[model samples]
Target chain A: MTETGEPEIDLLSHYARSLGIEVSGFEDGVPVLCVSGIDAIEGRPGHFHGGATSGLMETAAYALLRLALHERGEQAQLKPINITVQFLAAAKKEPLFAKARITKLGRRSANVTVEAWQEERDRPRASAVMNVMIARSEPEAT
Target chain B: MEKEAPHRDPANVFDPEKAAPFLFAGGHPGWLGLTYLGHGEDWTEIRLPWREELMGDDVRRVIASGPIFSMLDMGGGIAIWTRARRFVPIATLDMRVDYQRPAGERADVIARCECYRTTRSAAFVRGIAHDGDPDDPVATMAAVYMTIGDFNPAGAKND
Candidate 1:
């Protein structure tokens, strides 16, 4: 188990690793993760696959949630309840970046908002809202 | 019957039956081993078989929502082409997926999506992800896509 200095994420997660997501760094206490546009993730020629965009956003949100949980000393396993995403623009061949923050951490659940961009952070390629149920037990590999 | 189908020719109109292998044969969908189930005039179905790599919740042993999300997106896009009867590049403007229950519990998650409406540049889709019964769906999906350039058969895709 990692401490609370940085967002403690399981780097060995198959799905997250499969997407090639890596922690770039932190900004304003939030972790900004990134994934490259490799051939394994291409969609419709030059555009990012809708699902790939969603996955990145969702993974970023969970990383934030994990950080929040660790700060509270809560070993909660997260289960996604819903996710709504808006694709503002078509994502191109640039490296995709995403960051998220906890909107609300209730007793039984938590809400997170995430944004993804390619180059300019201000011009987000997509944004997402995710809600997950918190299982207050030993956190599993997400 | 699966591998014997002819290669997809870009010149023809869309047919999910013929295009399934081509679309899902590689890239993200193929990497996940998503299967093409069947299709109607306005809808298409695809399945995600269980794999250890697909596990999202290691404790609950559930397939991650991300793969399911991809399955829905692919199925929804194909449904639109099935309705349009032609291939056209489209962008996902927005999509919302609601998990009514948990799926991929050492089983399979199948997505059935229908393109119910299409304007000049936008298409709307709705569908469900279920283990076996559509009535008892694990998740529901709603999405809209904006077609690039002219949406006719002879038009070109914008990027």
Candidate 2:
């Protein structure tokens, strides 16, 4: 585990890989994921697509949950139950950042909140709340 | 306050079928392989075909929720245009998505979004995503979108 108590998370999903998301570093001691808004993720002429923004938020939330589980010495898989995303501003074609925090972690589920921003962290472009189910039995590796 | 007109002028009617390709092609939606399926007066349907790179859990062959959210977002946007009868500049204010179940392996997901209500400044949308059967939805969504610019459908003329 790193100094921030986050486990080494390797994004294995194609969705995250396709977006070219990476663990750039930590912000304010919290782990942050970064992605560049390329033409593939653009919506309007010069704006980032809302869907892609949500994808980044959800992926960030999953990474946080994975770290929390690792810290607790629990082996579990996360299944998304719900996500509520709120768009605050138009995201321009630039680098985007996302971070997540676990609000509540129960035996059967976890609630996480995530935010995405560009240029500045204080002025977030979007935020989302996600509830994910925690399953103990590990599935067969693909 | 006076009630706004429910329908935009016929001259400015927005045809979702004709606009889907232009709006989605070469963008995020196209990258995800989203395609226009069908539409109604106030509703639009779109499809997201299954792809290996989209898997959330490769073991279970389950696709990630991100693509599903993207599909719904696009569907919701198109539904708003269908209802407003014009392509008004808009932005998503909030969207709440509830996942009922993981999509089946190798099943293409279809999303149907309906714009049920609209005010002068905002439009309300609801939708469901299903793999094969519409009755057995994989996820449900409720969203709100706010209009931008001088978007007066009643007075605007189509170019």
lDDT of 2 at A17: 82
TM-score, prediction 1: 0.89
Clashing pairs in 1: none
The Cα error of candidate 1 at residue B100, in Å, is 1.3
What DockQ does each candidate score versus the true complex, computed on alpha carbons? Answer: 0.52, 0.61
Native contact recovery (fnat) for each candidate is 0.69, 0.93
TM-score of chain A of 1: 0.88
RMSD of each: 5.0, 5.7
| Model 2 per-residue lDDT tens digits across residues B83-140 | 8787777899999999999999888999999999888788899999999899999999
Instruction: Please compute the TM-score of chain B alone for each predicted structure, in the order given.
Output: 0.88, 0.87
Docking class of 2: medium
Candidate 1, residue B65: CA error in Å? 0.4
